[model samples]
Target: MLNRKSFGFDWGQFITGILFLIAAFVVMRYPLATLKTVTFIFAVVAIIRGIAILAGYSTLRQLTGKLAWVSLLMGIFDLVIGV
Candidate 1:
């Protein structure tokens, strides 16, 4: 017989997802006041995403080979847009 373990819920991911939803609601409710804040948040997220992609370039390249360049380009584009 094989021992199987059930996967547990990720509390951190759940909490962060909930927080993102609340933030979206707040932005929708008060667009004018939150416009700048929302943009800043977006820029930060883009920058972080770009960094993560670049950091994982090696693994991604191994997985996708020729297609990895597209991901790299996307990361660069994101970094540029974020800045």
Candidate 2:
């Protein structure tokens, strides 16, 4: 016989596992769509990161001297690529 501590009905884990299984099935059936969605999210994040880096350019410059210019360019490139 199992003890209550080890064999109780864990509703939270059960629901999470079920949802994970559903996601797995969908991913298997429509891999391209999932990839596209994930890519789009990454692009949005890149754009946000670019803006963030640009906003902090002065501090970055103070810390890294001339190397900051490379970061500024990278930020601009990110914004362009994301769009």
Candidate 3:
């Protein structure tokens, strides 16, 4: 079943691919800057994940018994590492 109305160029993918190529060039030209950028992105993600885990603590507590406190600890750890 070839749907004639369902085919078109993926502009979003094209733009993303182009942007990635440019980013690769920049990274190659400036390794230190790239490292910093990547580090910052990871830290932010980790911090957000930690916060989410902490927020769901009650549910986790019910499921994991005494081990739920570990989520709290990990969340704080994420905030510290992010900062």
Candidate 4:
């Protein structure tokens, strides 16, 4: 039998999603005012996400061997686009 841990709520991801929703709502509410701000925010988010993916390279590699390199490359692309 496969060993599986109990499924549980991930509060951190949930809270982060909620915060992103709130920010999106605020940006949508004042589109004109937040136009540039939203772009900057997205760029920063992309950069952070890229860094996070890169940081988890080892775990990914362990799971998928050579396939994991694709994710690493994607992360690098994201960083470049963000910058």
Highest-lDDT candidate: 4
Would you give me the overall lDDT of model 2? Answer: 0.72
Q: How far is 74's C-alpha from truth in model 3 (Å)?
A: 0.8
TM-score of each: 0.66, 0.57, 0.59, 0.71
lDDT of 1 by residue, 1-83 (tens): 22648656755345546656766987989887687767776676677767777887888899779989988998899899889
- Candidate 4 per-residue lDDT, tens place, 1-83, comes to 22757756755345547657766987889878676766776676667767877887888899789899999998898798789
Question: Which has the better TM-score: candidate 1, or candidate 2?
Answer: 1
lDDT of 2 at 53: 70
lDDT of 2 by residue, 36-81 (tens): 6556655666677678778879987997898999989988998988
Candidate 2 versus the native: TM-score?
Answer: 0.57
Q: Rank the candidates by lDDT, best first.
A: 4, 1, 2, 3
Better of 1 and 3 by TM-score: 1
lDDT over C-alpha atoms for residue 62 of model 1:
94
User: Which candidate tops TM-score?
Assistant: 4
| Clash tally, candidates in order | 0, 0, 0, 0
| Whole-model Cα lDDT of every candidate shown, in order | 0.74, 0.72, 0.72, 0.75
Error of 3 at 12 (Å): 23
- Give me the runs in candidate 3 sitting further than 4 Å from their true place: 1-32
Colliding pairs, model 2:
none
lDDT at residue 66 of model 2 (Cα atoms) = 89
Model 3 error, position 51 (Å) = 0.9
